[model samples]
Target: MKDRPAFGDPSRLTTGAKLFLILSAALLPLALIAIFATLQTSRVADEEARARLRVAADESARSIAIELIGDMVALRVALNALGADAADAPSCARVQGVFAQQAVDGTRFAVLDRSGRVLCGANFALPVALPSDQPIAAAVVPGKGLILAISGKRNGPTARAFFPQPFLATLGTPTSRSSGFSSAIVVRDQELVLDTIDNAGPLDRMETTSADIGIGDLALRASVRSAPVTSSLIVAMLLPLLMWAAAAGIGWFVVDRLLIRPLRQLRASVAAYTPGELIDPGQVRALPAQEIRELGDTFRAISRTVALHEAGLAEGLVRQTKLTREVHHRVKNNLQVISSLINFHARAAPSADAIAAYASIQRRVDALAVVHRNHFAEMEENRGLNLRAVIGELSSNIRATAPEGASSVSIALDVDPFLVTQDVAVAVAFLVTESMELAMSCDPSAQIRVAIKPSEIEKRAVLRVVSRAFVESEELRMLISSRYGRVMEGLSRQLRSPLHHDPLVGAYEIAVAVLGRD
Candidate 1:
């Protein structure tokens, strides 16, 4: 399976995501604080605006009350003056003149008797009931567009004044537009005598601040539309948002430049690296963040050390292979020398038994030489020798070096090509040589056949040498057993399996199992 690329792997998050998460973690508290500050500032601003509106309304109410009181005092003086004169045309004319001089332009004065009847005065058509104990009392008549104020000394003739809608409305006008508020004069909490705006809508139901006018049970109420949103208030509300945005932008820039970019570059460089290649120390040092720069430097050092170790390992492997090949070459040459010496001794022997023993020794030496030659030949490939090739060459050498009278003996091979380690090849060669020697001792003219195959049960390489020869005499059997029995046993042990001999199938069969190696 192909390996996944690190950069786009779904399981691993990017540096950008990590930096964004960090920025979010840092800014979350700041955002919450900003929101809280904004709400609190708005609340304070609203309260201040409401307080200012209430103060303005209170001042206007007091001024209006003072004006009403002065008008009442002047009406009382005119009523006292009119009390001495008769309720006649000349007296009423004189009293009207006195009231006009003491009241505002839109105010009308009148005189009323104890029966609540208008006796004589200007605008005296309506009868007004005056409270005996109270010095002043006011009534709002919306249908007539007038506010009636009744005032007199207790138990004395009462005086009445009619305030026009224009006069009452003027009292609330000064601060209404400038302060963004609606003003109203209410009498006894029931009648709206004058208002700067209509007070019949939902705005009337909103909470308002009131001040007692201190004249005739009248009150002044001011209802604000809303707290004005001044430039300072807007700034207070938006500054935190602006600051939060700026902080986020700045944080992203700083993290990207100092941390995210450097880490991304380091990851890319590490991913692109291969064994034995050195990373540039200058590249690692160029990182902006100090900690990441140090980490990059450490990684560079580790990669450099790994490259050096790998180079040393490669050089050691080459030297070891060369030394192994040289050793195998020398061993093959020494074995050849031993085989030549044995051949020389066999040729010089006087008796047939001595010559046969020497020849047998020469064959064994030749088998060992063949193993070294095969091993030396395969040293460059760094693999085991081919067992089939080694056994073929060994069988050929044995047939060629056979004794003169044993020329008729034939060796046939049914060997399959299999690769085995050096030690296994040597053991198999020796086992084959011992089997051939035993067959030759039994009968010099026997037909020797060597077959190699994999075992069915253990899956090991099995070398079977079968010789169609007979040991007709008990003396030859004893000689063969005594001479090669121990040698075969040792070769079997080297192969890690016992040597099996079966003579009931009309052939001397010796089988050795060879184990495989890495």
Candidate 2:
């Protein structure tokens, strides 16, 4: 026999469950790959944003450095021109015109003597001390701005330029607002020239780009805040999730329609089928899958084959029942004919003994005829004769056929209802006839009684015959011991029990136990 699925075994999974599992197994790796790709893409995007910010900061620093170097060079040339002319008024006005022409907004230039005294400039102050060897230097004055001091020569003269802090704010790239990076420019060893700290709000970390302005003393540091996560990054991260959900939905639809639904329909069809009923091939062919359709076809073929065999078996059973009934009918008719012939022979017998013998043979033949008649009657219904009915008929017949002188030998029957096979009923009928004949032969006026009842403990049926006028006659004993001994033995063998006899106080009793149908 084929092995059955255990409880909770995966092999017993329904079509839809199996389909869902298969789709899930197939999509799992693809989903993982999509998620991984989205994450990597987001990372790359953040890195690009940071790289752009760095590039912008670096470019701004280079531009600022070039501008600062140009300013310092112009300052040195102006200082040299002023030194060549004199510290007179006309030469001073000419130097002022040069400074005015070269200066941009938030820029201030001043000429200072070797004593560090400001002379021909705006927004400059005399310093308490000056560096002897430093060619350029910067300072952050409180509440003022950034100040750059450029020496004309070693301690000869110096030019000072003051740039307000707001000028440094313009150095950031235009994309800073969208990129979430704040820009700042700071002078080395001094205070911040420009700071976006207030505008930037909070800073996680700082990224800086620095450049030396080539004026030997000034360096510009361009700084910006790190890039924050943007909406594009969020969209990138969520894209894979959306794709996976959509793919799962689509997979469910496709697999359920093309595979699961059809298989479910096929399962329902097969479950609904009953034995001996026709299976429709059209319904089976409606499945979309080729292999499943073929399977349906195979099932249809098998069902058809089974139906054909059932039809043949039913026809054969009908013919056999009819043939059996006809055979029993013929046997009963032939036995009756033989009984009639014996009765006729008895009527024409030469002597009293011959007539008695013929009568006895006629009665026995009539008992057999009765058995066959009951068998024929039950054959059409596929059952046995009712035991009560058979016993009643047999007793009546035997008493009617008794000799003229034994007409007073009345038989009483108290038999229970029993259903037995044809062979058992026939054997029982013969046994009853023999017992009745013996009782009548013993005494013409004998009171004979036959009874059959079920034995509860032994699980069998018991038939008993009792006669009150038993004489213990020698002829009766000889008949039992010699002529009828084999007949009684055969009936005993049929009943699967011994024939028992008892002679007791004015009564002779005989009983046999037979296996019951129930």
Candidate 3:
């Protein structure tokens, strides 16, 4: 067992989703509140402004009607007193002064001399053109203080007003300009008394149509023309925003504190990982949220499992080292015994052919032994087999044992400087020797061609031993495809592969896969 390492606490975990929800919860209500507040405030302001305008309209209508009636009555009296006599001079003066007073009060008054001709102060009147109308020379007078107006109270491009009432009325009956008494609304110009509080923004925009006032016509019998201030609209729009914001805020709190923060901590641990280094989730806090707390526990469990796995892996590696050294020692001893046996046989042999065959056997055995020797020489940490040196030794030995004068039968190796497993290298060496001996026997003049291509794809070195001289031999083909092939096939099957052989135009090839390119 390896010594355990300490790990940090797992409290800080923030996921994007949780953070988003938090922010949304915090701001959603605020935004909604702002929107609703703004909308309702605007509505209240509009209603208030309209209401003010309506009040102004009502005041102006009353004042205008009073002035009109007073002016008209005085004018009629003045006309009646003009009997070409000086008897009514003071009366005429008083009446004229009253007319002047009415004029000074901003009432646009005119006395028509039966032909609708102006006969009073500010005498320029052909009464200003009415909206959709001509001044009613045709209209009959109703009773005294009877004010008439358009049925609708719409404001057009001109002043909107009209009144038809008894102008004389014996000159003594006091008349009022109140709705249903003396005054009414008209749409001809919309406002009978256009009282702007010292001229403001365009009066036209402020002007409301009869439809805007919830009225069918331009008539305003008793009410003001403009809208009234409404506090109700403000309250209506605010309620929804409050509910939404509260919900949003709660949601945010749940997501961030409960979910996001803990996940972020886990992510940090994952991000800071290195290969083979087990993370110990030591003393991790119970996350604020259930899911995050569970996740932390899960991560801790994984870490514990990882630590155990790492310890087992380390022990296995140590055992592998010891096993490798022992294997090398045994292989080297066996190879030495074989080499000694071959040397003894060669020295005592009566025939050169027997000596060569024994030498061939000895050389292959030595090749296997040399590979094992390399393994035994190294420590437990040293792993893998060197194929180049092994192959070269095999080739060199074969050169030494072949018939002394057979210079034409040359041997060459095309092997990469790679490492392979010991079993694979030993198999490869014997296969090469067998293949070369078979080729030499066929031609006695053939040059052996061998290639050791390390495959990056299969993660193995493939040894393809080819001989151009003995490429088309039926016996060699049978041995390769049947007998020797079976031995190689078993090795290949152990490595989870299949041995492959090919007869080219000028070469008989044996291909075997060995582990490792380098």
Cα lDDT computed for each candidate against the true fold: 0.72, 0.70, 0.54
Number of clashing pairs per prediction, in order:
0, 0, 22
In the range 71-160, model 3's lDDT, one tens digit per residue, is 445654555443233255665576668756434333333333434333333343233432335321212122212222221122211111
Worst 10 residues of 2 by lDDT: 505-514
Error in Å for residue 447 of model 3: 7.0
- Over the stretch 1-518, how does candidate 1's per-residue lDDT look in tens digits? 98766985545766666666667668767877977887787677668767777777777787777777776665666677556643556656665675574356566877876666666765455544444455566666653434555544455566778776667667655453443466667765355545544444553323368888877677888766555456776677778667766777787788889988899899998998898987778889899999998899888988999899999999999999888888888888888888888888878889998987788778888998998898888887756788878988998898887877777779888887777878888888888887787777678888988888776756476677776554345744685578777887887888777776665553433344444433
The positional error of residue 241 in candidate 3, measured at the CA in angstroms, is 5.5
Residue 164 C-alpha lDDT in model 3: 29
Candidate 1 vs candidate 2, TM-score winner: 1
User: What is the lDDT for 423 in model 1?
Assistant: 84
In angstroms, the error of model 1 at 120 is 6.9
Worst 10 residues of 1 by lDDT: 198-207
**Which candidate number would show the highest TM-score if scored against the true structure?**
1
TM-scores, all models, native as reference:
0.66, 0.64, 0.53
